[model samples]
Target: MRSSSPSPAPPVDLAKARRVAVEAAEAAGDLLRAGMARPLEIRPKGTAGDVVTELDLAAEALILRRLRAVYPGHRVIAEESGVNEGTGTAAGADAGLVWLVDPLDGTNNVAIGMPVYAVGLALCAGPVPVLGVVHDPVTRRTWSAVRGEGARGPDGAPLRLAAAARAGRADNPVLAWTQGHEVGRGDPVVLPLRTAVEARCGRLLQLWAPLVAWVMLARGDIDGIVGYRPELVDLPAGALLAKEAGAEFRALDGGPYEPSIDLPPAERGFVAARPALLERLLETTAQACRPAAAGTGSTGGTEGTGGSAGAGGSGGAAQGGRVRLTR
Candidate 1:
């Protein structure tokens, strides 16, 4: 509940949130890489357990008509027009500047072709997400961020975002999980990321977004990342680009990120590694979002906000590891 209205930090240029999210994430990554492997109309959104295609409303109508043709008083909380300019329950300072579109994060791995998927854009002025882009258009690669003039890639180049609080102990550390948390009974956070990726022998990459694992932990190439179901359109531009790339975002119930457009869809989230491995991965993702295990296996995808890839993952590799935790 912290919004005393001061957050104007970081780079925050608002370069129209990187030219309207890199032209709607490269036109929704060219209609998801020309319908990768082909055939997809899909369609289902809640009872069938959510789904949609036509390239997510053609990339949410080209990112809501290019952000209402240059911030038309800016207001958009998307995942498909849930709230555009006004309605009810849509709060991001009632539109002082908002556009948290996830035009196509990982529509179930882009309907199974598995190019990973991505196209997230953040730019909130009221609830404090200064600006962020995450395009991947199947490797066209973007990844912008701007809260204190940091986070950049593709065309702009400059990607560093690392603050690393010197805690040490990440042997392999490229872990991320989400698919079993309905109030725990079985998911004590996948037994500490399968015990820190089998005690650092690591290499179990699964991409489903979480802002492309916080832009591969600000390009350090994923020393640590974990998520259990986060939203607020997936954590304010990758938690301010993993705190300007010095990483460490906790909330296995430690709680804080309170930006809402109506918030309650059964809230859940977690992130770890970087700061004593995020206090033991937030105590194993808060025992896997407790409630004595409501479902199981954490399922997979949506909720790790933002987007992109072209290098990053498996914790520490980046000369071109080509990482993209989720589109």
Candidate 2:
């Protein structure tokens, strides 16, 4: 095997970082694609909701090793290792750079013969992610974003996302949501997407991983996506990419999702949508979290069911209002 070279030191050149990020993402994506078909050693974690597999661990290790080869000094915040290379993997420091790496976001889907999984990589400077890359190896599509430089397709083909902002509902701006069963207790909003919106135009895709959704949003493939429990590793790159792409992003309840380098997981709550309908969607989700609008228990009340863990139920019944999307 050939020996790997060292990554350039800090005051990271944004351009260089972007190039490295893109290259590394593609390489990591290739590894994932290579391993897709074989039988995977899968196991469960927490409840049935949590899962782990040999592929998940292997992919993460591959990414970590490769990224280190290119940029040894830069810090990393990952799901499996918590934090590494930055301030004892627990504390804060002035590293000024970190790579939020989620080697595989939809491991379950990928493992179970589903095609919705993806590999996500985001580069953050301080608290803001400046570069993002989401790759779907199965489909061979790569989505990327560079802060202030718009998101792009696999071949570096530029997308006109700024113009899409003024697009109307008739345009069928794509909209996505948090993972179906992954929303935590803190997530107070859910989607009851207007069927009219879904029927209007464009495509309706549900790729589970937040990074992939954000990438598609940035690429203008899909118009918008929302997720609450995005950890730092999950959002930084995607956030910068979307912002650079001219897509508006915020907490589903309309709050800031600025990630901290020192924090454990970027505390939940986030949304990304077209400026035209962002506020309205946020309002809709907020309304869904409220007590049933009195006598309106068909969809928004206890009459409704289907919630994951910690969803405010005495017997694990569906809790909260009618925010589950039918479309």
Worst 10 residues of 2 by lDDT: 310-319
Instruction: List model 1 lDDT by residue over 1-327, tens digit each.
Output: 112335564323467567767777778778777766578988755332345678777777777887766555556767655556733343232446666777676676666676766677777665567777877777778777776666677768767644453234255456554322122324344455445444443554556555666666677666666554444464566666556545556555455434332333233344544555666655555554543244433322222221221111111001111112111
Candidate 2 local lDDT, 1-327, one digit each (tens): 000122224366767777776677667777778777677776764432555667666777888787777677677766556466643432243366777777777765665677666667777665556677777777877777766566677777875464444345435556765433444333323333223233433554555566666666665667666543333455566666666666665554456544333332223445566566566666654444333223342222222222212211010111222211111
- The runs of at least 3 residues in candidate 2 whose Cα sits more than 4 Å from the true structure, single-residue gaps closed, are 1-10, 86-94, 162-173, 179-206, 255-267, 289-327
Query: Which regions of candidate 1 fall more than 4 Å away from where they truly are?
Result: 1-52, 62-68, 71-102, 108-119, 122-130, 133-169, 175-203, 208-210, 215-240, 247-327
lDDT of each model, Cα atoms only? 0.55, 0.55
Question: How many pairs of residues collide in model 2?
Answer: 4
Give lDDT for model 2. Answer: 0.55
